[model samples]
Target: MGEVAKIKKFLAEARYHHQEATSVDMVNVMKQYKGLVSNLEPYVFNDGTCRKLTNLSGTIPVRYKGNTYNIPVRLWLMDTHPYNSPICYVAPTADMCIKVSKFVDHNGKVYLPYLHEWDASKANLLGLVQVMITVFGEQPPVYTKSKAPYPTQQAMPTASPPYPVYPGAATPYPAMPSQAMPQPGGFPPYPSMASETPYPPAYPPASSGYPPPQQTPYPPMQPSPMASGYPPQAGVGAGGGTITEEHIRASLLSAVEDKLRRRLREQFSQGTAELETLRRTNLELVQGKSKLEGLVGRLDKDCAELDKAIATLEEKEAELEKGLGKLSSEEPIDIDEAVTTTAPLYRQLLNAFAEESAIEDVIYYLGEALRRGRIDLDAFLKQVRALSRKQFMLRALMNRCRQKAGLAG
Candidate 1:
């Protein structure tokens, strides 16, 4: 049978068993069936068939008084067997098992859990017994076919039969023509093979085919001065009808010379002004220097006069010093000695008059004798002493004679 037919048959069996089985019995049965199918070919069930079992009606699994259990439910399969399709199991509470309405994604394939709604009244008494027996029976071991089932191709009809045909026997039914197998609903259309059709040729490879148009080998161009028709040589001029190259060059030179001349004139004027200023400065310096020189000359003359005055004063001082020294060295003369040495006969006469004269006369004669230098100072002093002694003895004798003479009288 095809994969879809096999899935439909499994759903039918699950529905019949669900009506008779208790929730525990139903879970056990499902577990056994799951084990039995675990190794079956994956293509045996389509995703749509699984979804129908998950959303089955009426009987469902439920929790009563804190204990959980599965209740019998019914389902309709619309696609595989539209009429009188067997009812399948569902959970009383959608949360009891994974919702069949939800798909199971294993790798890229989708699997769905079983589901059912609950109904208390109707019972499948016989079906329940049969379901329990079926669940208890030893499960069939999982089997895998060694090779894939190949699709059979129908044989074509031949025009002639192998034996002669009876004339009136029911005409043998002509062998039916073989029809192409229907494609799987989910798979896409087959792609066309690439080898049959050719690709349009690529745009022809860029042409190097013709030798590039023969490049004319140009003659060596001669170098020309810009002054000539070509661009003016380094120091040349632009061409014009009336203006020759020489004229343009001359004009340029004249402009340059004019600029140089103006610069030179400016420099000369500056130099002249600087020179005039220096001349004035030089004149002032010369006048100042001359005045200084005259002051120096007058100072020299004053210095000379001072020197001469100092010399004359020194000469006069030296003469005065000599005279004072000579005066200090000279001795005073003795006037008496001088007179004695000069007088000759006056000495004896003065002495005789001094001895026989009266007192006044004697004083006069002594003075005369001193003036004549006749008296020796030493002899005169001795005479003066003898006279004093004589006068004293004469006084004593006169006193003695007076006493004696009176007695005698």
Candidate 2:
């Protein structure tokens, strides 16, 4: 998978994320650390809160002395990343030993000014990496382990020293490796143990840019027989013996083992990347399922409401059909007779009320006509006043009739 894709997947699969800003910052940060391998790993905090957080593990180039060396390191992004600083550590290999210094502790945890003064707005992984490279150059975090055998404590005759010792010195000691001296500008050069001797080369630096660079795995350093704790060969042995079949077999087996180990390491890394991708896919599937379930629930609710509305419409349609049939069966009636009141007194009141209603409609129409310029304003006023007087007289008569007929006005 692509580096960006891998970084996104790592964030998505992480057990906990404090905020969106953290994820956004992580994307940009991961781009800078393209050489590092990103994955979600469980981390236990001081308070015993175990959480799976995104981590970038691998080596970054540190220029020490006059050569560049890949320093193995790991960075863990906190749940509240960008806002909080990431935890960093020196990851030494089996053949190497950790060198405790001001920047690195006995436990391999890194400490630096940049990390201590981390700013959410300005501080980033790239800056932190640069700081690490500079600090590690001054004081290398790790060194190759010595494989020389220990001498017996048996008392023996003391021989003259091959190398002259200084005054007050009990025994001669090997010269200390020269410390890296910074140049006028740029980073300090790195020291290489394999440079002087025929030891294998360390891992190379990973490329980084807008277009993600590929990670080229460096060949693992092969162990020299002298340092590998292997028995002396041929004339080198105490008894000056020739090369044997057993020795050849052992040598061949070691070479095969190294090849197998390198292959297995590559395969393991590939499997891990694929597994993370699968986890991301699974998470997406689960989210999609939840959305589909919610949509289906809403659809079911809408269907139930529609069913009720359909039933009410059906009832209304039946009532309308029944009324239509009754009207069809009835004979045609005179409009005036059809509207007649039950009693004579009520009939008189109804006629007066009808006249008052008619006058109100006439007055309204006259006002509308005046507004639309259909009648003059003076004629509209005179006609409205007359209609109003008639309407008042008709309303008074209707009230009296209603009282006599014992009906509500």
Candidate 3:
């Protein structure tokens, strides 16, 4: 089949541009599109970049009502390979004027976020195209000629081209035969009362309960007293009797009902208009909510990354503090021989402190007692206190010992 060769050619082109594509990825593309596509063609751009095109004209699952039906889908791939996402449309029969909607617009543009966010580095061409096909299966666009909000509601009459009149239909009174037609008068000559053209029924049938009373053989003529004295009134009905007050009352009631009916229709039309406006408003709100939720999800992900970084920093701080503690805890400061009266005992203390394992038994216990007794005072004050008290005591003891030794000599 031509279609099969086209797919093979497309695969070859895809492999050519994407040299890094793995064998497994190529196999996946071939297997996935075995018979799903019905047509394929290729074209080149002005810059000589090759583009692949394909269409699945067979039954693609399209949803309507509560059922999914097969429909044709046309697709066009970008000339720049995976770098450009494909553009798709749902093409119905010639007689079908597709409805404009969220899924498919008047121009047949399909709305799918995957195509909108296509990334050449990540998205596989075969998989992305498959996604596009599956999108229509879930909730297909509703195609209707009316395409009005709340379609089940009453349809408001809109201006439209006139349709051909059918035979036997009540038509407007025809103009008098050319010879009988009036030239100067704005109105057409009235028809013969003797003829049977019961006035053309109202343009729109009367909505009131009662029918309009038939013409009483006269135009705007009231009963004349001279004719009332006789058996027949001048403008009375064919019955040739005096007109009664009841006829007048009945005609007046019909007029009132017709006026009320027209007003009711106007109010109904206004309400439907308002409902359409509200429907659009609700749609806009839904779109804004979706965008806001997407932003919040991104923010939450960023916050999680920041929290991990902060935790890593805290762990590093703990390790650094432990190292500093070990260095300071193990060493003792050396004192000058002239300043210490403790003699060789002070020298022995400094040498024992230098060897990490020298302190034991009584020596370790005494060192521990001295360490526990020391207060963690302010650095400047603690240093002053250490030097003044201990150094003064050691110096005085050394002077006394020297004097004693000299006396013995």
Candidate 4:
């Protein structure tokens, strides 16, 4: 599956509180941040409840000392996302150490003004990550142990306490103006790397692949005398029996076999992990394919139903059109003489109902005129009362006539 498809699947399985909104936000973020990978991972909240949540884990670029470094970061989206902020952490590798500062705590949890003042209308994953990159550029969250001279125990900076620092607590890693400034004897620089010169550089370049490949050293081996074009010589043993060339040959062969076995085992382990990852990817693709097929089938069924409905509507339209043509061909009849009642009593009842309906329209217009100041309040009230009394009499007459004519009232 593609990245967007994978992200949709992950969010779907996790059962987010706001699925549609969260999916849109995450899809945009994933597109902008192609390096980041989305997955469903278990997240433990402060209340100790663990839930599987969508996680975006990857590295972001931060420039320091004119060089760019890919800073690893992990974001845990809350189930009620868009409304809630994501939990962000600076994930340091084994060789890297967390540099606690105003933005990052000892536990690698990130704190930022944007996150503190999160407005769902304006704030989003893309903006949150941008703020992190900018803040980290000024004060890096993590530094490689090989590049920075970060001692196990160092004096705290005296300037001001960083976040996670209690209200009245002492500042963590406080440094004096002289120390913060890279003087002759003061700290090397604000960051203070292990090296005085930036040769190998801290972390890998931003362009390097994620989770950079490990450089495994070749197994050490002591060369055998046979390589020198000289056969092993027999030597006198401490016990009195002479050491033979065959013994030396056998020892060298055993050493070579052991090294080969270890190398093969390492390769096998790495291959197995890669195979399992491929298997998971294949399963996800299969599921996506099944879902798409089902959707297509539903769409086809709906289309067929729509076609049947259209045909029914067309038939009804044709019948109405034919009837309209017949009426057009005939002469127009006076509405009053269109139908005559069988008895005079029924005729009187119909006329009374018509007069009563006319009175209702008159009263409605009077009210509208009153509302618009077209008539005075006294006149409006007087006219409404008179019309209402006439309407009531007409209705009574209709009821009496209906009874005499044996018609339903």
Estimate the TM-score of every prediction.
0.23, 0.38, 0.30, 0.39
State which candidate, 1 or 3, has the greater lDDT: 3
lDDT of all predictions, in order shown? 0.36, 0.65, 0.47, 0.68
Please tell me which predicted candidate would have the highest lDDT against the true structure.
4
Looking at model 1, report the run of 10 residues with the lowest lDDT sum. Answer: 200-209
Candidate 2 lDDT tens digits, 76-139: 9987777789999999887766655456665788877798789988997778888898888776
Candidate 4 lDDT tens digits, 284-364: 789999999999999999999999999999999999999999999999989889978877888898899889999999999
User: Given candidate 3, what's the lDDT at residue 219?
Assistant: 24
Per residue, candidate 3 scores C-alpha lDDT tens digits across 322-391 of 9889978977655554345346654544443333232233344444555786544354355555545655
Give the residue spans of candidate 4 off by over 4 A. 146-409
What lDDT is reached at residue 105 by model 4?
Answer: 63
- TM-score order of candidates, top first: 4, 2, 3, 1
Task: In candidate 2, list every pair of residues with a backbone clash.
Answer: 63-189, 63-190, 64-189, 64-190, 64-191, 65-189, 67-190
Candidate 1: count of backbone clashes, pairs at least 3 residues apart or interchain: 23
